[model samples]
Target: MKLLFSLTSLFLLICSTALAYDNEPNGFKGLKWGTSIEEFKNVYPNATLQKQQPGEYNPANIITYIVPINESKLSGITITSPFRYSFYNNKLESVLVTFTGKDNYETLNKQKILLNRMSMIYGEINESSGNNIDEFIPGLSTSYYNFNYCWKGTTTTINLNGSYKEPNLSSYLSISISSVEIRKQWLSKVKPIDKTEWSKIRKNIISEYRSDW
Candidate 1:
């Protein structure tokens, strides 16, 4: 299940599509895609550098910064999550906002709330869903499930993704926003990735759970 989930996420990272939707989100906060990292720091002085790590699909390392503004309203629902901005080649390439709850039910409920809001705003441009159930032991079962809704604009793509695992009852929910157009530009200028960098640049999604949990 872990291997399958990772592969699917990797494919989606490379296959981000542009759409004609006018209401889709194209940037993070008020910053536009491809904004310089220095300028980003100027606009967000309180943002702290998380790491300068290899991006999932880029040859060089990408820098990540985390800000304090964590609560956001999805239409009427209030969601609290850690938000990170990532830059590749000194330009903003992606933003990730994630929320994970202690238990499955609470996380799933929040996922539904956010999904409803996304549907209202983005109109559900795409859907990706799959699951695997395994009877690991006698009278015991293990399962992994994934469901994601996507929307795209002229330059960006957004995905509201949810994943649940049985036995552990752990859940992960995220709002992943990427500059699909800028990513393409970056891809054009970078060197071809070798085996070592390819392994180093594996997708590193940092998911933060609720503190109250």
Candidate 2:
């Protein structure tokens, strides 16, 4: 009996390993990492491009495109949620899908479908939690979220999360894919500004100017 149990355990472990390693190439909706902005538009003509104003944390001239679900297609599935694509330095870097509606079950079903489809392509989910609300406050009539799902691959990371807020139910899913070099360059462009250090530098400059006078 002991030997038999050990063999079964070993077999299960091997199968799990195989499932984890079995993944499709790093791409979503026919758009691969490093796809040019013009190429993305050519593929999805209905997508609307919008430029975000540069800020301290996001110094790069980041541009985003909103692609309606009706215009884009995911293999073996149909989703009606809008997709938001962000591009930095003219290259696609991330994609986001958000769903908000009155029906909680419907939103959850949709999220499940999406996660299953992504799993088929990206292999078994890396980590997941919070599929349902943990607790509800009666007087305030508020629901708390304990829900999040995530998957990571060699070149991409995907997240699916849902939350319920009083009147409406909402869910969010996103994938970020990029090559190591591209990610490094993008990070360099959007590095956060050190506010405290900046203040100190400004103060020093001001003090120096007063002394010079």
Candidate 3:
């Protein structure tokens, strides 16, 4: 009975996690990941792909687009911003959206709306807060916070971050959604350290022999 109960619990946990990611979000703006550059161009015929890094980099290609600011034109979406897409292995890996404008109550409200929209699709989010300052400019501090949401099925992560300076004059928000598998595959290709070899080196000791001449 105990084993059966444990099995049942495991099944329930798996099901709950699966249900959390009912919508398998791949890309934004009608674009999906794992699509080749040619395929992307077919969708957005005039879209241009810019190479930001060397071919060795995981995200070697990028495309930035400006979204319309007219709320009604965007169908009641006021949080219009530019989106940057990072492509790896000829496939889209991450999408970063930047919300611009002076930091104020209005900006915060828009951010809240964006978060709500994302939550509806990505599920509950894990929120966090932090502080950031310009190292060169002293006394220039800002409040920085972010909401991170993840899905188990696709191992995708979505991060919504906001930063604002004092007096709410300068503020901006950024949203990033990335695929975990793509990141892991790319990161693994970077310079990797051999822990076992490092440990051996750390334990190696030179014998001290006093030579009396």
Candidate 4:
């Protein structure tokens, strides 16, 4: 009985430690994608963001933020944009940025400003739901764009696309930025779910929303 009790206690301790590390801020807890507007707000309270109403070109909500993590130590940042309708179909767009050494902030800031500008470009269209925005701006393609970010040996690329739409013409954007080194170190120390697991979590959230609608 004594040996069994000791083993049970040890197991509980390990479980508790794992849960603590998993829920830590700036950890993987913050790197989720495809989450709803409400869920995103819960995680990023400091983002001070806003959502636009549906219109001719505008989808639904526009979420923008300057990541709260220490940019200097980050390995990369990824932004995932997913659009779902009252129907069951799901559309996803992703972008990545990798940065290292000096000028990291410059590159990161540039990306940030670009996102903000993009938001403004579509701001009116987003407000009107694509009605007011001109269909042909010379080389312009679509109105919606998705992207991601990461850090490599001082070089980074912000991938983007203008394809995605919501049922009510309302769309969703989820951004996640992290340092590769920090993520690996923390994950190595804790027993959190891997990327596959995290992806499931995101999918489940989307599924739940779909079911509710």
What is the C-alpha local distance difference test score of each model? 0.64, 0.51, 0.46, 0.28
Better of 1 and 3 by lDDT: 1
Return the clash pairs for model 2, or none. 130-146, 130-147
Minimum summed lDDT over a 10-residue window in model 4 is located at 84-93
Q: Which candidate tops TM-score?
A: 1
Clashing pairs in 1: none
The positional error of residue 57 in candidate 1, measured at the CA in angstroms, is 7.5
Residues 40-155 of candidate 3 have per-residue lDDT tens digits of 66765655454332111222223433333334212134454544566677776666665544444555555667667866775665433343221212124344232223344445
Could you tell me which 10 consecutive residues in candidate 1 have the lowest summed lDDT?
132-141
Candidate 3 lowest-lDDT run of ten: 204-213
Candidate 2 residues lying further than 4 Å off, grouped into runs, are 1-21, 51-59, 71-78, 129-141, 167-181, 192-213
Ranking by TM-score: 1, 2, 3, 4
Candidate 2: 10-residue stretch with minimal lDDT: 9-18
**Against the true structure, what is each candidate's TM-score?**
0.72, 0.59, 0.57, 0.25
Candidate 1, residues 160-213, lDDT tens digits: the string is: 776776654456667778888777776677676566765654433222122211
Write model 2 residue lDDT over 1-213, tens digit each, in one string. Answer: 112112221221111111223564455678887888999999989999654321212345557798887644454344445777777788877665554333555555555676677767667777666544334321244453434556644566555555443333332233333333345566565545476955654455445433322
Give the best candidate by lDDT.
Answer: 1
